[model samples]
Target: MGTRLRLTAVATAVSAVVLVAASVLVLALFQRQVTDNADDLATSRAEDLAALAAAGRLPDLLTDIGDDSVGQVIGPDGSVLAASASLGAAPAVTDRLGSEDPVRIDLDGVPDDDETEDYRAWLVTAQGPDGPVTAVVGTSREAIREDVLALGLALLVAMPLVLLAAAALLWFLLGRTLRPVEDAHLRQRTFVADAAHELQSPLASYRTQLEVAQRQDDPAGWRAVVSDLLAETDRMERLVRDLLFLARQDSSASAMSLVDLDDVVLEEVARVRPTTAVDVDVTGVSAAPVRGNRDDLARLVRNLLANAVRHASARVQVACRQDATGSLLVVEDDGPGVDPGLRDAVFERFRRGDPARGHAAGTGLGLSIVRAVADRHGGTVRVADGGGGARFEVRLPRV
Candidate 1:
């Protein structure tokens, strides 16, 4: 399955399990709570009856208990004295237990198996001057069963709806979260197709030019032309590399593991030193580790360095540092600083400063690639204010 489907399935399964467990817990607790309520009502009635009989006001006292509990009264010797109408015909009250304490028993009138009768009753006692009077409250067991069954049905009906709502929320969030990835993918595909078509014309022209230069046999002129063609080829190679990196990042196939950013910066600085004409400076050296794809990190550093060298007239400074927020990578070029208004525009793919004045051959994808890599690493890249030059800063979380 695709990643989205797998993630959705996992989320749905976990939600279902949790919802089912919660529903079961609520149902069980509700049933127990209701049962307790019934028992408490029965006990309260038994208490009121004991008080009435103790004061010699026993006549019809059982009827008053009828409101919340089925009531029947037994004489001091355990013979029936009164019974609630709802109970219809019950057994002798003396046949039940005594004391203010309550007990559950089967009722007399309802038929059970061929040999016995069926109905349920609570047997409780009332205190008397000489002995204890019994109060029996008979109720249908079906009452408790009906309440519990209703609760179970409610949960069963609600659970599926809850699960669907949760799944829908997650699905929407996933779409929003993956929007950037999808956009990058589409942009890359378009870039590849356009790049191929654009490169074909230049390559064909260079081939034709080389053939004509060869025929001339003029060493100086031919060498200059060959140099220009080689430069174009290098620009094409850089563009291809950037496109590949972006594709890998969007696919999330790039290796993301823990590495020391300080070390990577040092290595890149060393690599750039031999080719760069301007002086290089490294500062804030520390073991700043972060989780990232090492090769992408190297590419990001290389592009930033190349951009600095291409534009800097006097100095290029590279620094690595860590702070509370994250690891910071700063590259500054002591050349003509970028115009304040154009800093944002410079990062766009194929955009360059003063294109009319001609720039060293470049595919103009460096900054775009840098931003893509930073995003993959869950970091950011932005312009930093430099006193008399342009500065680009990259920030990533330190592990």
Candidate 2:
């Protein structure tokens, strides 16, 4: 199972165990409390009955004890003198050991079918007309059993529902908590596959070129081979650099300082203007200060430029402006812009606009890096809408 599910299961199990233990403890205490109260009441009433027998008024007070009670007054010879209506003329409930303090004992009568009875008795020796008599006060345990049974029933019925509700809540919460982890896992898988694909072509080309050069053994041929090797190495190095940059971003933050968007854009424009046939426009550019790492902001501009330089048919516009909201950097190309449907997909890692026409020997991570920098700086990057060509825009908050 996944980490989230395992954690939730453990939590649920612990909660259930604790809850069950607490319920058992509560039920046991309830039983003890009820039984203790019953014993106390029975012993007190037995004392009253013994007092009446000693005063020679036992008969008058005999009916005073409730019918639910079973009482008997016995002479020292173990013969009954008086008894409650519930146990009329019954023999002594227990052998009254000559003790002043009350003694408790269990009393069972003839079993009725398979059902048993709830009987608990208390015996005490008190002063009587016949030297000394024993008073037995026995009570049914039905009240205590009923109360305990009700609690047991409640626990049995409610525990499952409580656990089910807790499980359902945990399922939802764990899903929400692990959603980002799942996304990152999928992203890592995709990244590894795409990185391997990008590196494979360069390694294979290097191998084939080296083999070709070895067969010829010509000085001129080896030079050309070395040159090609260098270009391929450069390409691989750039890809590795981009990948490392992204990895580092996940681990820590870069130093931040105020930066001018115009300066960064102008520098990137100057660096690329000579390499492309596309006509570049910088008339719309302006200075807009913001807080960010200069290197990352510069890379963001370079990637946008590289993207435009590779795809634009004739013209690419680099524009910058500042507003109440933030600073905006807009790059527009005069080629067939990104398909509106694929606009969002274009910024994803390892995504390509056109493998045949626009890959441009450049890594597919260029736009992804643009978006990452924008995000790291608490900014946003998006495709601007203007109908004809692709318009990419980056918005960064001011310092």
Candidate of highest lDDT: 2
Per-residue lDDT for 186 in model 1?
A: 72
Q: Could you give candidate 1's per-residue lDDT for residues 221-288 as a string of tens digits? A: 97789788987778678777776666666665677899889899899889999996789888656767
| True lDDT of residue 176, candidate 2 | 92
Error of 2 at 76 (Å): 6.4
Candidate lDDT values, in order: 0.75, 0.82
How does each model score on TM-score?
Answer: 0.52, 0.83
* Candidate 2 regions with alpha-carbon error over 4 angstroms: 10-23, 51-69, 73-83, 110-116, 124-134, 169-188, 255-258, 274-277, 354-357, 397-399
Where is model 2 poorest over a 10-residue stretch in terms of lDDT? 109-118
Give me the overall lDDT of model 2: 0.82
